[model samples]
Target: MATLYQLHSSMDKLRRSTEQMAQTWRAGDSIILLGATAAFIDWLNAYLEDNDIDRIASIYALADDVAQLGDHTNAKLNLNTKLTAVLSDTEWVTLTQDPQFDKVVTIAL
Candidate 1:
């Protein structure tokens, strides 16, 4: 499994390249890039959902950090929202089953 750090670094690179391409105003190319980025985000969301308990905790902690960044954060660009947006309400409810680190998970949720 790819670590979150690796995913972030790769996504950052993809965004920079996509931004550069968008600057050129080539409509077709820009659309392709947009689709690719969306697909990548979907893959990431699935990965997070399928990860083990420890990894899920790590992801939640990461999300909490973003939430802590305050109200100035953009809804479109917020990592926590992006990450959690993939989860269904039912999936979220299941997370409470793990007895360990209940406090951390609750705070993250």
Candidate 2:
């Protein structure tokens, strides 16, 4: 049987490993994430190759721009500004078709 001290040490190691994996994933450091998921490394490689990094980066950059605009100002506090941010450049029909959007509106209310 394993001693309590041995169990504690194993748990600590697991915690450290999981934390490291999460950090690497959040940082978009694909190399470390791929190493951690050794079995899925091939899938990761193929997925990355098939995906459009430039398009993804531009989308995230736009989201960051919106967030920055909302920050350092009372834009978020203003109902009109919030609506404009959420609806600007978005088709009303498309926005209405999103199922999750109702939940967002409910939460806002």
Candidate 3:
């Protein structure tokens, strides 16, 4: 298979998985977004509001990704995100090892 085709397929699968998660969102479902997944936030928020679904959303984002998006609003873009800039591999492994964080149905990173 062509590299471009594989990339597209992977992206399509990711989008579908994310959309399904958003659709069936529950109160305690916290999102650990890796890479640059900020664009989905607005849509997810709107979907929750429009459906009258309430969730205590804890969004974890990489500080570097937000910076790469440009500091247009002086970091206001990360107002709702828990930014982690210097977390090591071991730190992440430890954090995700919590039993409560085991509901990981889809990982896009």
lDDT of 2 by residue, 40-83 (tens): 22343344444421111100012332344445332433323222
After superposition, candidate 3 runs with Cα above 4 Å error:
1-18, 22-24, 51-53, 73-91, 107-109
Cα shift from native, residue 40, model 3 (Å):
4.3
Q: For each candidate, what TM-score against the reference? A: 0.22, 0.19, 0.54
| Candidates sorted on lDDT, descending | 3, 1, 2
Q: Which portions of model 1 miss their true places by more than 4 Å?
A: 1-56, 60-85, 104-109
Candidate 3 clashing pairs, residues 3+ apart or interchain: none
Tens-place lDDT digits, model 3, residues 9-95? 133345554455555566665554454554344554554455554654455544454455566642555444533232345654555
> What digit string (tens of lDDT, one per residue) describes model 1 on residues 1-109?
1112212224545544333323332211101111123324544444333431122323322323344444554354454454434324353344433343222111000
* lDDT (C-alpha, whole model) for all candidates: 0.32, 0.26, 0.46
Best by lDDT: 3
Identify the leading candidate in terms of TM-score.
Answer: 3
Residue 54, candidate 2: C-alpha displacement in angstroms: 9.3
- What TM-score, to 2 decimals, does candidate 2 have? 0.19
- RMSD in angstroms between candidate 1 and the native structure over all alpha carbons: 15.2
Worst 10 residues of 2 by lDDT: 1-10
Question: Between 2 and 3, whose lDDT is larger?
Answer: 3
